[model samples]
Target chain A: MTKVTFIEHNGTVRNVEVDDGLSLMEAAVNNLVPGIDGDCGGACACATCHVHIDAAWLDKLPPMEAMENSMLEFAGGRNESSRLGCQIKLSPALDGIVVRTPLGQH
Target chain B: MSRCPSASTLEAAPIVSETVIIVGAGQAAGQAVASLRQEGFDGRIVLVGAEPVLPYQRPPLSKAFLAGTLPLERLFLKPPAFYEQARVDTLLGVAVTELDATRRQVRLDDGRELAFDHLLLATGGRARRLDCPGADHPRLHYLRTVADVDGIRAALRPGARLVLIGGGYVGLEIAAVAAKLGLAVTVLEAAPTVLARVTCPAVARFFESVHRQAGVTIRCATTVTGIEGDASLARVVTGDGERIDADLVIAGIGLLPNVKLAQAAGLVCDNGIVVDEECRTSAPGIFSAGDCTQHPNAIYDSRLRLESVHNAIEQGKTAAAAMCGKARPYRQVPWFWSDQYDLKLQTAGLNRGYDQVVMRGSTDSRSFAAFYLRDGRLLAVDAVNRPVEFMVAKALIANRTVIAPERLADELIVAKDLAG
Candidate 1:
């Protein structure tokens, strides 16, 4: 299991150990971290799972796909650090990755 | 008159002693539990479900779960520890046999009675089964629960002949998976075309062609007479006297809302359990949500009985807020999606009463969006392989935005700009 940290908008931090091959959204959702609602169940259809990657670890993640980029365009508070948690699958190389969720997910 | 409680009121006076009993553990029930806790409702929460397992998502059951790409563990709406951590008492594998509105008590099938201050009925719906001869055959199946899909998956052998009744999303999705898995699949639809009730003929044609290209035979305007078979072999008898042999028959005709309990209690049920904007049933202190409800839609100015994850989650939150005395109207725009053979069809708003359809991009490229308009107002949009259009259209529909047909169809204009 790889360790992942989720920082809520209210500054509550939750560290979860997630199995490899699972998306970061699953990691936070499985661990019951608030804010990141993967309502689409990692289908990347709903932008509810939007998250801002910690700037330092942003480059370590894979580039966003076309579908993710399109969906992110309409996500609330889109920014350079913004990515859908469902699109970011956790791997051994990305151990101890950190991300922050928005105030509310639409 | 009871004044609606605001956030301040809830924080100041939390009803910790009251008990909230939510029936039917599905997506809506799961969301209501989370929302109740989030809304500061520290009341006793009891979740009773007829299913043996915890609340799990139903979308993947037709696509990934049936295809073997998604595991059963991932199907759960939350981990096992979530209910425990959230202080939710779950009674699985039991049904609510009776509801006493006057007494505010519910009797479970196991002969246990529980009283509650607020009751939420998220009973959802059941798969509409085919009613005909041999419909009770063991080889026949429906895709509504994990158990239903498990039965279908076992019959999905590589060379097996799979007959699917009803060409709706569920049937087509299963067809896609079975075809990819090397099974011979066929779809029979009683309507003139597949997806006739949900989308336009153009969109339906697109899907029909896609399924045909995937080596699945689609028979439209065909009626099934009965199923005739013995132990080792099964055959589907069509209305025209042609008998088609099949190893397994799966039906996805539609859903029948589980409103018997609510109706028996005299809660004013139409096609579904009737609820007001606050998700309150005719009976005071009783609420209903998800596919089992025919709640009012402020966007369309009509009552809708939707069967989608979006409706389930949003209505669950609305019901929770109302139960906390923070009454808020449930008026979010309805949206739905379907996946088949790398194609994602995302729809927003209701296409009912549409007068014209504006097409964006080209169907030749297999990526396009169809905008439905009534009196020049955007009523809905069907986006196929067009995520950008789907997202923007949802917002535009919610805002009731109006745009010219030419502008909506122009590919040069960015989708986001069209919103303005």
Candidate 2:
């Protein structure tokens, strides 16, 4: 299992150990993390699972697909580090990945 | 702005001795449990569900679950440990046989009685079954629960003849999955076109064409008269006297809201359990959410009973707040989506009572949005692979924004800029 740190907007930090092959959204949701909604069940349909990865870990993740990019265009508070949690799968290379949830989700 | 009480305020408040009994453990029931805890309701939470397993998402049951791409565990909204950690008392595979509103208690099928200070009726709907002859045939199926989808998946073999009784989202989604699995799929719709109840004819035509391109046969204006055949084969007889042979049949006609318990309890019900904006039922201390409640929509100036996941989740949260004395009104534009083949159809707001439709972009490109307007005001939008338009249109509809048809149809005008 890889360790993932979810930093909420209020600065509340939660460290969770997620199994490989599960997406970051699943890790947060399964662990009862508050911010990430994952309303569409990780279909990349809903943008409620928006998150921002640390700049240092940006290149470690997979490139954003066309659908994820288009959907993120309307996500609230999106930026350069913004990515859909459902689109990024966990792997051993990204052992201690950190993602910050936005102040609010769409 | 109405804000929830801070964590410190909730902690400082009196210890809650009240118990909240939530009936019908589905999407709304699951969310209610989470919301109650998140809102710092340190009370007893009992979730009663007829289904044996924990609450799972039903949308994937028709798409990814049927396609064999998403596993069963992934369909669950939350893990088992989360429920335990949340301290939720769950009664799975048990039905609420009686609801005594005056006494503020419910009788379970297992002869157990539970009293509650607050009652949440999240009892959702069931798939509407066919009333014609042989409707209960062993070969016929309806996709509503995990068991239903599992049955269909087990029968989904390559080259199998599959007949769909309705051309709605569920049936069409199954048709897409079955066709992709190399099955001979046929869709029969009773209306003049597919998705007639939900979308306009133009959008329906686009979806129908896409399904046709995928080699799925769609027959509209056709009604099934009966079902016949034995173990080896199943035949569907239509009103046109055509007997369509099928290895199995799936029906996605519609859903009938489960309101028997609410009705028996003497709560007002009109098509669905009648509720106010706060999701409170006719009875005091009793609230209802999800597909079973007919609540008012301030935006539309009408009552609506929505079956979308968005409504279920939002209403569940709203109901929880009301139970906690937060009492915020529930009002939001409804939205729904469908996945067929490689296309994604996202809809925002209701297109009902629309006076005109403005088409943005060319449908031939397979990426366009249809804007529904009434008296030059935005009412709703049906976007096919147009995520930006869908998102902007949702906001525009909520704000009752009025945009000219020419400006809406112009391809040069960016979707976001239309808000100006």
Candidate 3:
């Protein structure tokens, strides 16, 4: 299990143990963590599951693909650290990864 | 602006102990409940659904779930504790039989009455069935509910013959899964081409070729006349005097909005329940959203009834905000997607009135985007396995950008650069 933390728009931090091989979006959704809608169910189609990876852990995670980058362009409040939670898979190597969700994704 | 649910306001109203009752438990209804709580509406929220289970995602019903790649429990949008934690009272296994508009109350099938200060009609829609002889046979089926897919799953045996009535997305998606599962699948479409009503002929032909290459037989302009069989086996008769024996038959014609209850309550319904930009129905203190709503799309500049999860979720949020006294227009750019085999077809914007079609990338390579242009203005785009192009096209369509046809047709130019 990997320990992940999700910070909401209002600075509400939620820490949960996510299983390996599960995406960050699924971890948030299964644990009832608000702000990550995952409307398309991790298909990488809808960008509702937008997130901002903490700067410290950015290099530790895999690079963003072209599809995810394009989808994030439509996401509100997108920045250089912006990444789609659905495209980020959980693993033991990324145990203490921290991410922040945007205020809205439309 | 008249504070009485007018169409011109973008502000939230003051909240009280008002009870907001949402009818229909689907993606839209689920979003409505979530948005209400997210917006800090402490009022009571009662969700009434006909299905026994909580709200689940429907897109997987014909794809992953059918292929046995996804479990039934995973399809649920949220766990059971979600409603309890969110303070949402759910009425499952019972449907609202009657709606008394004046009283702001709905009568349940079990003779229970629930009154509310505001009501949300998200009744969704039902699958259109085959209106032919033997259509009621025990071997025939229509996919809409979990039970329907379960029944079809049991019949999808290896080497078993499966006949799909329509060649729409649902039918094609199911055919892809059925073929992958070792079933001999055949699709019969009444239109001249599969997906004729939704996509351009070029895109339709592309899909047809993809399905044919997968060993699925597709016959266009051929209507299923009748289904002749009992409990054991069946034969699907066609208009051209040909018959194909099958172990199971599924109808994927289309969906019809569940507007009988809304109509009975004297609500204005055209193709669907008519609502304004704020998702307000003709009646005050009442609103409608999701597949059951026909609202004006500002981007399209016309009223359209979209049966997509994006539309449902977006409209549900708009209705919930309006109920909380925050009236914002529902002007979301309509988008939809479908996954068949290894191809992911992503469509952005509505291509209703297109005058020219520009092909970007290589169609032979099966990775391209079809740009619909109306007098040099981007209208819509159908991107197959090309997500970047589809995403850029959405921005172009939303901005109503006009581009030279040569730039769009040039595969050498990057999607972002072309849009820029």
Candidate 4:
């Protein structure tokens, strides 16, 4: 099983099992995590799913596409490792990736 | 041409943080932030916004927010502390003046050059302002933001003579609420009906009769050419030179995407930022969603910009997934809803390209559903206070299946039973 770690803004760590085809965003939503709203239900329209991906795995994920990059530009508390979680799909290769949460959203 | 200063400094910074930076806070912005956290991404996230308040919904600004039924706190997608607990660092009332796409850096109005690996634009849409004579009169108002709603609510002091220019959803919603509060309302529409282009003829007629019955003076096939008054509008002149009494005038022409920033950055822009099914823009490393981006929705069978909360939230999720390299081309049914005059109108799917329509229930009953069929396939369903029918009709649109007219008209069959 693919394993992913989520470090909330308050420093709470949660480990989750992920199917190869499921997205990181889908995994979090399915597990009932609170920080990510995913209001658009994985559409690129809502920026609530912004996440800071672990830098070590940055090269493992594909480069930010035009649409995803444009949206990350609007996320709250943006950072260098900032990425929308829905844009990251779990894979066997990215089995041990970790991400952090931002501080404010509105 | 003069450029916003922060944008220029953006090129110098290198994106090194684990958090994502989202500029322009709005409904789409808020949804993106929430989705990122829910998706198990634990990194420092920053949201820069030009507005001072937290991201709240705008649809209710014209309806419940204006009517005072929706409290300001309820308007919030989440309480302010919720974002704090979520660890979303929001810089409000601060604009991103410059963007260095090459460097993946953003320059804020305060001259902070921050870098971002991923950038999302949830800038949302804005109200198309009027430019007619006396359009700037203090008495004239345009509804789009929270401040605009607050001003209109304050102006709606009992017995105010409110003149609503452009009898579309916004104007009609205000009219309905104002009439109930004992304010004399006049709705001016250029089309013969209040909502001609947006809804079916029957739907438009239904709203017209509802407003008239409520004692709202709705003038169809009329245009306001000029507004006259020193500070506030005192009178409005029509295309035919007819003058009408007015205390406050609200112009509800429509909304356009906040695409100036994106356009300046050399991103492709059609009527909106054109995105494929996954909400990808033409440029590499950039994605546009929400009202600012237009996608060829398989559900609509046409390129369109959806301004509903549901659309924005769903699209935001798809964009996040695409960014995660788990791209599933967004293919979801489109749904929308509106409330006016105690009547709730819900729609699933696009009614365009429909050749035939069958009324499933009685409009006279004040609760019914209209099934729009194209080539014997269900295209859309407009339900008025009929949530049950709306659900099944949504399934019907997704399935593209046909329902017998007899079964549809029979309430005994019920929506759930027809699902079989």
Candidates 1 onward: DockQ, in order? 0.77, 0.69, 0.53, 0.07
Ranked candidates (lDDT, high to low): 1, 2, 3, 4
**Fraction of native contacts under 8 Å reproduced by each candidate:** 0.76, 0.48, 0.48, 0.14
Residue-level error in angstroms, candidate 3, position B320: 0.4
* Tens-digit lDDT track of model 3 for B136-215: 88999998888788888889889999999999999999999998999999999999999988889999999999999999
Docking class of 4: incorrect
lDDT of each: 0.91, 0.90, 0.88, 0.75
| Candidate with maximal lDDT | 1
Clash counts per candidate, in order, are 0, 0, 4, 101
Name model 3 segments beyond 4 Å from true: A17-22, A30-35, A59-66, A73-80, A91-93, B1-16
Give per-residue CA lDDT, model 4, range B8-104, as digits (tens): 2323432223557777678778777776665544567788888898988787787778889757765666557668777889999998887777777
Per-residue lDDT of B305-384 in model 2, one digit per residue for the tens? 88889899889999998887776788898988889888888999999999999999978999999999999999999999
Q: Deviation in angstroms for B144 in model 4?
A: 0.9
Between which residue pairs do clashes occur in model 1?
none
Better of 2 and 4 by lDDT: 2
- Model 3 interface DockQ: 0.53
Interface RMSD of 4: 14.2
Q: Which has the greatest DockQ?
A: 1
- lDDT of model number 4: 0.75
